[model samples]
Target: MKISHLQTRFILAGILLVMTTVVSGIWSAWTFAHLSEVAGRTIQKSQLTTDLSAVLSDALEREDDALLLAMSGDRGQAQKKLDAERLRFAQAFNRLKENLDQPDQTQALAQLAKHAALYRAAGDVLLTTVAPQDAFRWYYQNVNPALRRAVAACAEIRESNFRAMQRAGIRARDDARGATILVIAISAAALLISTLVAVMLARSVLTPIRELDRSVEALRLGDFERRVEVTSRDELGHLAEGFNRMAEALAEFRRSNLGEVIAAKETLEATIAALPDAVVVIDPDGHIVAQNPLAKAILVATKAQGAKIVDDLPFSAGSLRAVREALEGKPTDETRAELTRAFAVRLDGQPRKFMLTAVSIPEFQPGRCGAVAVLYDVTDFARLDELRTELVAVASHELKTPLTTLRMNLMLLGESAGNLTPRQQEILATAAQGCHELASTIDELLDLTRIESGQLRLSRELVDVYPIIDRAIISLRQRFEDAGVAVQVAAGHRPAFVLGDSVRLGMVFTNLLSNALKYSPRGGCVSISVRSDHNGRGPGVLQIEVSDQGSGIAEAFRERVFEKFFRVEQHLQNGNATTWGAGIGLYLCRQILEAHGGTILCHAGDNGVGTSFVLELPSPGTVEQ
Candidate 1:
C-alpha cells in the first residue's frame, strides 16, 4: 500500500488506541461474567440453606404441638396437624438436597434425611398408641431426640453451604478487582505509548517543514549551496528532493557568474598593485581580507622581526582606530578626519612618514561589510617642513643679538636728551619702542621653533602657582592701568601648588593677563582668580581663570585664536586702535601648559562681556614628614 507520511502516522496511532479499547472491553466482560456467576451461586445457596433451616425448625415445633395436643385431648386433630407439617418438611428437605453442591453439604443433607426418617417413625408410633400417657412418653423419649438430631444435621448442611458460598463470593470479588487493575494498567500503558508515537511522528513531519523554511531563508540570503537532506520515500521526502534540485540549479547558475566575479577581483588587485600608495582591505573584525604588493611590502618591512603578517601589521594604532570606525558605519567625514594625520614607521632603520585614509564599503550582506585603507607616503614633505622650521629658528636667533643692541643704543640716545632737540628725543623714543617690539617678536618666534623641534626642557620644581599668578599680575599692573582697566586678584584662601618650571608657568599667566589688558575697554575690569580643586581627572588640581570685560571673542574664531599669527577682526564700535602682538603669546602659553601636564581653555565670560582663559594644572603631591 502506498501510504503517505500523515496516513501512516494516523494508522499507527489508531491501531494503538483501538487495541487498548478492545483489550479493556474484553477484560471487563470476562470479569462481569465471573461476578454474575458468583452472585447467582451465593443467592441460590443462601435461599436453599435458609429454607432448610426454617423447615427443620417448623417441623420440630409442629411435632411438639401434636404430642402435647394428643396427651391433653383430641388425638385425631393432633394426628392431622403432624401429617401436614411432615409433608411440608419433606418438600423443603428434598429441595435442599437437590441444591447441595459440596461433598460436606451433601453428606450433612443425607445425615439430616436419616434423622428426619427416624423422627417420622417415632411420631407414627405415638399416633398409633391407644394409651394417652404411653403416647406422650414415646414422643418425649424418641421423637424429641430424633428431631434434635435432625435439626443439628440440617444446621450443619446449611452452614457448610453458606461457608462454601462465602469462599466463592470472596474469590469472585478478588478476581474482579485484579481484572479491573490489570485493564486499567494496560490502558494507561497504551495511552503513554500512543502519545510517544504521536510526538515522534509529529517531529518527523515538522522537521522537514522546518528544513524547507531554513533552506528558503538561506537562498534568500544568497547562500545557493544549501541543500535539503532527504531520508524518507514519502511526500515530505519528495519535497526535499525537489528543494535539493532547485538549490543545485541555483548553485550552477552562481558558478556561471562566478567567472566574471573572479576576473573583476583580479582586475581590482592589479589596479591596486599598480598604484604607488599602499592599500589594504579589512573586514569588520579587523582581519586583512586583501592587500596590494605595496601594502604587503610596507607592512612586512615595518613589522617587528619574526612577527607574522596575520598576527601583527605595520598600521599605526590611530590608523587602525580610523578603520574600526569606518567598519562600524561612522560617517566618512568623521573617519577621514580621524585618519588625516601623519603616521611614522621605521623601515630599514630609517623613519618614513605616511598619511592614512580609510573608506567604508557598502555590503550586500551587512555582516560582510568592511573597510579599505590607503597609506600615502609623505616623507619628502615632512623633511621639507622640518627644514623650514629650522631655517626660521636660525634666522630669528641671528636677528635677536642685533635687535637687542639696537634697542640699547636707542635707550642711551633718549637718556642723553640734554644735547639734542625735543623732536630728536621723541624720535629716539619711537625707535627704541620699535626695537623692543621687534625683539619681543623674535623671541616669540624662537620659542615656537624650540617647541616644534621638541628641544624645550623644563626646570621642574614644587612651586606655589598663586605667587606665580600674583607676579604676572604685578608685572602687568602698569599696562592694565594705562588701558584704564581695573585689575582684580581673587586668590583663594588655600595655596595652590604645582610641579612645573616657575618661569614657564609664569609666562602662561603673563600671556593671558597681557591679552586681557590689551583687549579690555577703558575703565573695564579684568579679574584674576585662583582656586584649588580636583577636576575629576585626578586628585589635587590648581585652576586659574583670567577674565576680562572686553569685546568677547566670536565663537567662530575661538578655536583658531591659539594658532600662530592668527588674529581676530577689529570692530569700529570698540573705538580702540588695533593691538599689535605676534599672536604667538597664547600659542606659547598652550605649549608651555601642555608640557607641564596642564590644559588651557578659552570661553566667553559671564554676561557675554569678554573672554575667559582657564588654566588647569596638576597639583604637587604632599610629602610625608
Candidate 2:
C-alpha cells in the first residue's frame, strides 16, 4: 500500500492509533507491574525488619530475668539459666544482624553482641567469686550496670531497626507517589498524542472532503471546468486528478464539437453570402432551414397566394423530386438541369431559369441529413449555347455548296493536267485532296451543330461493326499509302454487330483510322482490333482499339484530347502556322460514343510502344435500358 492510494493513508492512520494505544497500554502495564513489584517487596522487607526488632527486645528482657536469678545466690541454677538466656540472646542478636540491612543497624547489633558477652561475664563473676551476702551488692554494682548498658545497646539496636523500618515506609510512600506520577504522566502523554493523532487524521481527511464537496457542488451546477486541488499524493489526490481529467476531457469534447459546429455554421453563412447564386438550405424533413436574400426574393415572388418551400416553389407535380435525389448524392448533370428549369419563378411576368445545386451538409450526427441548394443563373449560358449552335449550323450549311464546287473544279483541273510536270501533278493532287478535306470538315461541322442542338438522333439498329470498320479502312487507304504507314487489322468476330447508328459509328471508325494514318511515322505500323469487355467469344461488350506506332501522346493530355477544340501543345492555325488536323475529330468521336451509351479511353499501346484508343460499347444483348 503506497501513499498514492488512499488505503495507505487509512492504514497509516490506523497504525498510528494502534501504536498509540499499544504504547499507552504498555506504559500502563509497566506502571502497574512495577508498582505491584515494589509494593510486595517493600511489605515483605518491612515485616522482616519489624520481626527482627521484636526478637532483639524479647531477648534483652529474657536476659534481664536470668541476671536477676544470678543475683539470688543459686550458683549452679543461675549459671545454667544464664547460659540458656545467653544462648537465646546470641541467637536473636545473630538473627538481627542477618536481617538488618542498614549500616547503623548492623553496628548497633554488633555493639549489643559485645555488651551481652560482658553482661554474661559479670553474672559469672557474681555467681563464682562473690559471696551470696555481698553477691547481691556486687551484682547490683557490676552486673546490674553491665545489664543496663546491654539493655541500652539492645534498645539502640531496636531503635535502629525501627528507624530503618520508618525509612522503608517513607521509601514505600515515595515509590507509590512516583508510580502514581508515572502513570498520570504516561496517561497524559497518551491522551495528548491521541488527540494530536486524531486532529491530524481529521485534518487530513476533512480538508479534502470539504474541497471535494465544494467542487462537486460546482460540477452539479454545470461548471465542468471546476477541479479539486490535490493536496497530497494519496487517494484524495488521485481522485482529484481523475476528476480534473474528466473535466478536461469534457472541455475538449465541448470545444471540438461546439466550436466546429459554430465555425461550420459561420462558414456556410459566409459561403452563401459570397455565392452569386440564390441559395436555400433545407433539412431532411423537407423544411427550409435557411435561405439567402435572392432565394427569399424568389420564394416571395413565386409563392402562390400562400405557399412553402417544399411543394410550392416552382414547377408542379414533380416538384422537388430532384431535390430528394440531390440529397441522395445524385450526379448533378442528371438533375441540375431539370431542377433549373423546374425552379423557374416569374420575375416581372417572365420566368427566369435557375440551376438548383444541392450540397449536403456533413452529418454531424449519424442518420440525419441537411443539404444546401444553390440555384445558379445559367439562363445566359443556355441562350449563348443555342446561338453558337445555330450560327455554326448556318455557317456550315452556307459553306457546303462552295466546298463541293471547289472539289469538282480541282478534279477537273487534275484531269486537264496530264501534260503538267511531276511537281505540278503533285500539287494538283494535293489541291484536290485539300478540297475534299475541306468539304468533309464543313459536313462534320454541320453534324456537330446538329448533335449540339439535340437534333442528330441516332437510328438504332443492329449495325455490323465489320462493315463500319471495313469502310473506314477503305476510305483512309489513300492516306495510309501517302503516309507510308502499314495498317494491320487483327482477327475479330466475323459478324460483329453493335446496336448503334451505322452512319455515326462509321464516322467514328473513319475518324480514328484517319488519325492513325496522319500521326504514323513513315513505314510505321497501325493496328486495329475489335474485342469486348470479355474476349470476343463471350456476349459481354464491344471494344475497338486503334493504335499507331508513332510518337505516343503524353499521358497527361490523353484525357484532354477529347475536350472540344483542345489540341495537344498546338493552336488552331490562323494563317502563318503549318496545319495540323482540326481538333474536333476526337471530341465528336466521344460525343457520338456517349450518345450510343458507350465510352472511349486512351492508353499507352501494347508493350508501351505507341498510343492506343479503345472504344467500349455494349454488345447487342448487353445494352441496359
Candidate 3:
C-alpha cells in the first residue's frame, strides 16, 4: 500500500505538470493584459473620433451658414448664430484634444484647430466689410478654403484612429494565434509526460488511496464512526492514521457539545416564544421548520394555503423575490425595504396590518441556511394614517366646488362695479383679490390630493424644452415688465430635449420664474439659464436655473422651502398684490421632478444677491447608457 518507485515517478510528473501550468498561465495572463490594453486604447481613440467628428463637422457647416447669412446683410442675426456654433465646435474640439494623445491624432488635432481659427477670423472679417460684394468676396476666398481645410483635418484625425484600431486588431489576431500555439504545446508536453508515468504505475497504488478517499467522504457526510486502516510505515500509513484520529476527535466533540446544544436550543425557543409578534422559521428547501404561538394569528389572517411560508406570506412579489435572493446569498434592496415597512393582509372583509422583518440564520447544516420572518401587529397605527390621508382628500374635494362658485359670484360683482363709489369699488377689488388667493390655495390642495392618491399622471413625450420655457416666460412677461425686472434667457443652437409632460414641466419653470419676478427689486434682473451635460456614460443631464437679483433666502430655510405648505413668513407680504405665492408650488415642483427621476434644489444666485432654483433633469433617448 506504500508509494513504490513507479508511484513516486507518477507523483513527480503531476507536480511538474502543475508547476509548468502555473508558469505558463502567468505569462499568458501578462501577454493578454498587454494586448487588451492596446486594444482598449485604440478603441477609445476610435470611438472619440467617430462621435466628435460628426458633431464638429455639423458645427463647422452651421458656422459656414452663419457667414453666408452675414454676407447677405443680416450681420446681427448671423453673429448670434455664429457665436453659438463656435461654442459648440470649440467644446467638441477641446474634448477631443484632451482625450487623444497619439502623435498622429495630436498632429491632426493641431491642424484642425489652426484651420478652424483661420475660418473664424475670415468670417469675422467678412462680417466687418461694409460692401456686400466685398463681404462675399472675402467669404469665398478666405472662409471657404479655411473651412474645407479644417474639415479635412478633422477627417484625418478620425482616419488615424481607425488605422490604429485596425493595427491593434491585426496584432491581437497574431498574438492570439501565438498564445494558442504556446498553450497547446505546453499542455501536450505535460499530458505526454503524465500519461507515460501513470501508465508505468500499477493498479496496487490506488488501493490505499481509495480507502482513504472513502473514509474522508464518510466524514464529510457526518459519519464520524468510519475510520481508515494503516497497512505500512509510509505516506499512506501516516495519512490513514491521521484520518482515523480526525474521525475519533469529531465523534468526541459531538458527544461533548450535546448538552450545550440542547441548552442553546431551549434558550432560542424561549426567546422566540416570549416575543409579542408572530415568528416563522423557514429552512433552505422552503419547509416551515418552526413557529411561535403568535404565528397562528398571522397564518389565520392570511389563510395561508401553500406548502411554504414564503409563498403564503403577505408581502408583495418583489419583497418575496428579494428574500429568496438573500437566501441564495445575493441580497437585494427590497430585502431591507420590504422587511422594514408595513405589510397588509385582507381577512374577513377587513385589513390586518403588520410590520414585517427578516433575519438570516447561520448554517445549521453544511452549505445550507435559513431565515426567520417576524410580523408585529400594527393595524391600529396604519389605519390612523390611512384615515388622515383620506380625510384631507375628501375635504379638499368638498371645498373646491363651493369655492369655485363663490369666486364666480365675485367676478360677476366686479363686472357691474360701475354704479359703486370709489371706496366701494376699492373694497370690492380687495375682496376679489382675496377670492383669487383662496382659489389658488384650493387648486394647490386639489393637486396635493391627486399626488397623495397616486393619480398624478404625466402625458409624456420627447419635447423641445426651449419652447416650453419661452411660453412660460411669455405668460409672465407683463408681470415682470410691471415690476421693472429685466429678464434674460441663455438660448443655444441646439434644442434641450427631455421626456416629460410639457404642461407640467412648463408649470415648474413658470413657478420658478414667477418667484424670481416676485422677489426682484425694481430695476433688477431675472436670468434663466439652460445647459446640457453629457459625460459619455449614460443619458445626459439637462440643468435649468432661474435666478433673480433680490434679497436671497436665508440658508436655514432653503431645504424647508420644498416641504408641503412651508414658506418664508417674511416673504408673504413682501411685495404688491402681483407678487405672492402659496408654499405648495415648490413642494409640488420637487414631487413632479422626483417622479421624473430628477431633482430640484434651492441655492443662492450667481452673485449671492437672490435665490436660485436649480432643476436638473435626466435627458431621455438621446444617448446610450
Candidate 4:
C-alpha cells in the first residue's frame, strides 16, 4: 500500500502529458480554423480575378470584330454586334463584383466596370461620327487594349492574394507542427524532472533504512559503537535519528557494564595478590607482564628481573630452567624443580630448601596469547619434606637393626621349636611374616621420601624401555592373577630405548601397573603400551601408556591428581583398593620424568570412560644432559 517513487513519478508525468496535450490541441485547432478561413478568402479572390479576365478577353474580341465590320462599311452588322457584346460584358462585370469577398476586391471590380463602360461608349461614338470606319479603327487600337490591360492587372492582384493564402496555409501547418514538438519537448522535460525527483526521494528513504540495517547488524555482532546517518527532515530521517539515539543509549549501557567487569577483575586480582603465593603473568613471548609483591620481593632478593632463568641466577640455574621449560608454551603437566630459598645472612645461616612447584600455565583465552605462573612458596612443605626424609632415613636405620635381630631370633625360635609341636612352628613363621611386612612398609615410605625430596640418585644410561616394562608386568603378575585382573604389554615394532635409570624407570612402571591392577574390576584389562619416537634426528624417546578401566578422575581434579597426598574420595572407598596410595606415587613418577627431561600426563582413556597415564621420555639428542 506504500507509495513508491516510481508511482509518484508516473502520476506527475501523466498530469504533465495531459496538460501539454490539451493545450497544444486547442492551439492547433484555432490556428487550423483561422488558416482555413484565410485559404477560402484567397480562393474566392482568385476565382473572381480569373472570371473577370475571361469576360474582358471576350469583350475585346467582340469589339475588334464589330470595329472591323464597320470599317468595311457594314453599319447594320457593326451596330447589332456592339449592342449584344455590351449587354454580355455588363452581366459578366456584375458577376465579378458579386463574387468579390473583400472591400479591396470591390476596387478591382470597379476598375473593370469603368474599363467596360469606356469601351462601350467608344464603340458607339465610332459608329456614328467617322463613317464607322475611322471610329472602329480608334476603338480597336485604344479601348480594347485598355480593357485587356485592366483585366490582366486584376488577375495579377487575385493571383497575389492566392499566393499569400497558400503561404498562410503553409505557415499554419508549420505552427501546428512546432506546437506539437513543443508539447512533446515539454512532456519529455517534465518526465525527466519527475524521474529525477523520484530517484532523489527513493534515495532519501533507502539511505536511512540501509544505515539503520548496518547499525542493527553491528549491534548484533557485539559492536555497539555504530549509529545511523540521516540527512533529511522526513519521517524516515526521524526514524534514523531515533536509531542513533538508541545506539548511544546502548553504548552508555555497555560502558557501565564494562566498567563493572573491569572493577570485578581488579578486585579478583587484589584478592589473589593478598594470598601468600607469588603469582606472575607472562606474555606469549615469555616476558613477564604482571607480578605480585611476593614475586617482586623474590626478584629483588635475587636481582633477577628481566633475565631468563638459566642466564640470571646461575646458582639457581636449574630452578630457572625448570620454570622456563614448564611455562614456555602449551598446557603441560606441572613441573616441580627443587631450589634453595636464600635469606640475608643476619646470623650467618645457610640457604634453605624451598620446593618449587612450577606448572605450565594453561592458555586462559584459547586462541589469545598469554600465560600465567602461580608461584606457591612451599617453604613449609619443603621442611615437611625434609622431615619426611629424615624420618625415612632414621626409620630405615632403626627398622633394619630391629628387623635383623628379629629375623635371627625368629630363626632360632623356629629351630628350637622344630623339635617340639607344630603350633610353635606355626607361631614362629607368622612372627617372621609380620616382621617382613613391617620392613617392606618402611622401605616403601623411604622410597617415597627419596623421590619427593629430589634426592633419589639415578644412574642414567641408554636402555630398552620394554625390558623394564616386561619386568614390571612379571613382577606384578601374581598380584593381577590374584585379583583376577589381566595385564598385557602393547609395544611398537622397533625397540624403544630411553636415557634413564633402569631401576627408577622400572619402579615408575611398577607403581603404575600396581595402580592399574588395584583399580580395575575382575577380568578387566590393564594395557601397557610402549613405543619409540619414529624420527631419527631426536633422541629415541620411549612412550609408555598405561590404561585401566576404573572410576575416571573428574575434569576439575585432573591437574590436582598428581599433587602429593592428593586423593579423590571415590578411590578410597573400596576395601581392597590399594589404588588409594600415599599420593606420592604419581608425584614421584612426575619428578622422575622431569629429572630425565621427560613428561607424564593423565587423560581420558581410549574408551574415553576410564583413565590413561602417558609417559614420554627423551629419545637421545633431545634430552638435556
For model 2, the superposed segments whose C-alpha errors exceed 4 Å read: 1-271, 279-375, 417-419, 533-539, 554-556, 570-581, 621-625
Rank candidates, TM-score, best first. 1, 2, 4, 3
Clashes of 2: 0
lDDT of 1 by residue, 1-625 (tens): 6456767767877887788778777777887787788778678777867777778767867877886787778878987887888888878777777777778888887898898889878877776754675766677688889888987887787688778878877877787788788778877877787788778778888999999999999999999989998877788999999999998998998899899999998898899889988888877676777777767777677663333332365556766667777787664432223111467777678888778888887681466567888888888877887787789899998998888788777777777888998888778867776786577678778888888878888999988776887898887676677678898888465556688999988878878888888888998998988777655456687778899988788886676677656667542356565775666899898889989998888899998879999888888533323
> What does candidate 1 score in Cα RMSD to the true structure?
6.5
Candidates 2 and 3, the one with greater TM-score: 2
How big is the RMSD of model 2? 15.0
Cα lDDT tens digits, model 3, 461-555, are: 88878889999899778778878999989766357789999988887887788778878899999988888886657788888888898888888
**Candidate 4 structure quality by residue, lDDT tens digits, 344-461:** 2111243433334445655634644555556565656666757767887887878888788988888787778848678877777778877865665566667666765557788999
Ten-residue segment with the worst summed lDDT in candidate 4? 339-348
Candidate 4 global CA lDDT score: 0.68
The per-model lDDT (C-alpha) reads 0.77, 0.75, 0.78, 0.68
- In angstroms, the error of model 1 at 25 is 6.1
What TM-score does structure 3 among the candidates reach? 0.41
Writing each residue's lDDT as its tens digit, candidate 2 over 1-625 gives 3367567666777887788778878877887788788768766765776676566566666766766776664656856776776677667666666767789977887787787778778877876788778877887788878877877886786677668767877887887788788878877887888788779878988999898889888877878888889888877787788888988887788877997999999998888877788887777766777777777777778664333456655644443666665566553342324222335566667767776666666571367666667777777776776687789889888888888888888888878897899999999888888877887788788878877767888998987787788888888788888888889789965666788999999989888888877777899999989875545465567888999986677776787788666676483234343337777889899989999999999998878888999999988633322
**Candidate 2: pairs in clash:** none
State the lDDT at 367 in candidate 4. 46
The weakest ten consecutive residues by lDDT in model 1 span 331-340
- lDDT (0-100) at residue 358 of candidate 3? 63
Q: What TM-scores do the predictions have?
A: 0.72, 0.51, 0.41, 0.51
